[model samples]
Target: MVAQEQKSSHVFDLLVVGGGVNGAGIARDASGRGASVLLVEQDDLANYTSSSSTKLIHGGLRYLEYYEFRLVREALIERDRLLAIAPHIMWPLRFVLPHSKLVRPAWMLRAGLFLYDHLAPHMKLPKSRGIDLRNHSAGKPLKSEYSKAFVYSDGWVEDSRLVVLNAMDAAARGADIRVRTRLAAAKRVDGVWEAQIEDKRSGETSTVRARAVVNAAGPWVARLLSDELAVPHSKSVRLVKGSHIVVPRVFEGPQCYIFQNPDKRIVFAIPYERKFTLIGTTDEAWGEAPGRVEISPEEVSYLCESVNRYFEKPVSPSDVVWSYAGLRPLYDDAAANASAVTRDYVLDLDTTGGAPLLSIFGGKITTYRKLAEHAIEKLIPEMPVLAGQSWTADAALPGGDLGVGGFEAALKRLRDAAPFLSLTHAWRLTRAYGSRAYDVVGAAGTLEDMGENFGADLTAREVDYLIDNEWAVTAEDVLWRRSKLGLHMTQEQRTKVERYIADRQH
Candidate 1:
């Protein structure tokens, strides 16, 4: 057993250093397994690479080419599990892939999709099917020259909300979640580890002692390993920068398009936030620091060109409403091409160095839960009394207890209770809050009871609930993570919210 280095007021079984999907998911899982957990984030939850992902809960069909069957199958299985558990936030979307004889032969696409269908346990999701693009609704917005299409199913997640929900769930299970609490330094004292946490807003510093520390800091994994843990290692992480563009919705229906580019890379044009089409992503090797990740004009042009090749409605730079870029903290496999770098995660457990420090290398949002399970399993040998069973796969998130009447039933309940609420507002409330929407809205019989309407589907009541419950410290945290109202809110509305938060700090 590791002896205590010094007396500390706050001591936990596990201390997680990142608030992205993996860190949040691990915190939630660890707390649920009866471990005292503390999760500290330098920024808001999902403020970094997690929110910047393409936001698909996919099995990685393309990974088939790399023969990553284990990863693909595990991810495929997790997709159905997440859909059943978080129906309000995640759902199945069909991707139409127009056949290009030059890129991939039809048979290869068919076989991959077939393996994806069979690899996972069949849930509510349907299998893939080949389609004649000329006759299908999916191809209505595609060029007439593309005749054949392959349609497959995968889950889509509201990326930031997913991170928030996981954090909320972890909090509910008694995890101490501290946002804007940056990890300044960590050192092993005797047999226990002590870490200094600095509150970004208060500018105050505190110390936390923990038996085990988890380095789940996404792109900053190596930095934490070297600078904080002071571990001497020579491992490098390949940072691949990916960018996405949001354009006006070109198709009439909910279907998304997957185009095969001449470079043998794929791009997705998904129906986003109802009125926008989300297209992405370019794989470029990034030497820039992770904190400086941003969309380049060249990458934006490449995305537009790729989409224009298959779709009837050609997109230009002017058509873009929003653009985002993130650095994928991939395991440095020394691959010749950036796109070919492995997406699978690697864990370096340093147990022999007085105290244990587990550093996570690479991972995706889709497989966060399973990754947490594996992480916990790795630590069990060190702490033999720890429980071995996994509990997250069947567990519901904070608001996920409501059965799969899907999002509609929750929305209907909200509307029926508050007859005065607008359809748009009610739907947004239900979708964002799930079964717990009423808990915040309360028995408000009228709009006045719900408090001030800030902007677009946002209200004072919701903002208050977020700050009180989800650790929303800033205006950007509220608009982006707790909700997507920032996209629809005007500058004046956002400024008002910012002012309100600033005033509250004093």
Candidate 2:
């Protein structure tokens, strides 16, 4: 039998590739400004790099030494902006950088902190200051050698959820979001992009047309340009593998610690999931294929040793419960090593053949919003003018209606209204869904009404909601990305969820 070809019914003004934070934010910004948008992803939203982040909305404090003052300043500004818009998924986090004269002298640390404090004058987080570890609460978890430290403020984010919320907002503002949909190929045809997109689930190929394409393909940015679109480009990304390990809680504190290594690199031990400490990230370079990314045994050992130097209790590879690694597609700035490579993004817009193709290179989670806004501005000339073109700078994402510092109030409201919910269950709902927790709760007056509870209070209702709304297609999507309940679920329970999603989809 001959194959049948399917075409998307409507042509979009902008076709965004990748469903990570940058692509989602671009879709949200463009669609909100009256541009018809279509965002396609090969897997679930944030299936890779976006979700495997340090999960901090920080200004890259260490970037100061590399003379990345401008990048740091821009990130700091966006960090504040993101906090106000999505306070539910983000919160204020203070970092304690233990001072070591051997690694970095006190004067050098103070000068760097001073620059960090004033780089963005409008920064809402508290200014950096020196502290006596002997008297500070953060000092209790440290070894005796660390006598002084510096405290500065940044924000923490539920990384993957932030990506989903952006995609949700874009969908709400009239963008078509297709997950588990891969863009196979595309070329300029008749002054637009005629592309082949495949449904990864059903193996069905379809065609979509768009006036412009945004290559937010993260690690695949360069390959997409040369192979898929067949567009010639001079810019490329340096894929650096960053790995993180989660161990049983290492310390008893809300604040986090940033440790200095003998090699002059820094490692962070962050309080995670209430019962574990999140430690990461090696600067090892990744030169292999894009899709397969994993933390090597060496990287794991490096991270453990990096943190053990300061913590009163030591951590080893055997103590790690879960570990993850992601590739950082840094714009290849011809830096000597991966550690010195710039973390700032560069938008390469080409209008060579007919339509516009915008390739995003090198960016962190803290700067995605600004990157999106900048992307749309660059493409505005290529696409039609949007009426009343207001940017997403001040817009609140879906369920972000709770004002700044209102997360606790929102949690209280959820508990009061849903008296049947355990505080832990209610807290998860509020943080993930925010003002929409009531929607997830639905009209259920009892826990049983929400249906079967497994893996520490994950209910049938919540899973259904994720399937129907958030484009969650698989069990891993629910257990790992949507929430970190996988860590709590037994292998048997996880299998049940996998079967449940499959059955529900059918």
* TM-score against native, each model: 0.96, 0.98
| Tens-digit per-residue lDDT, 449-502, candidate 2 | 998886779999999999888999899999889999998879989998988888
In candidate 2, position 335 carries an lDDT of 95
Model 2 lDDT at residue 250:
92
lDDT of 1 by residue, 1-506 (tens): 32223336766889999999999998998888888899999989998889888889998988888998898988888888998788778888988888998899999999988888898675457888999978888778877988998888888998888998999998888999999888988888767678888888777777889888999999999988888778776677888999998888867887877888889888988988878888998899988777847788998899999989987888999988878888889989899998788888888888865678888889888899999988988888776524757899998887777654667777887788888889988877777778988887887778888777878857777788888888898998898767767778799999988887787778
lDDT of each: 0.85, 0.90
In terms of lDDT, the poorest run of 10 residues in model 2 is: 382-391
TM-score of 2: 0.98
Error of 2 at 286 (Å): 0.8
Which pairs clash (backbone N, Cα, C closer than 3 Å) in model 2?
none
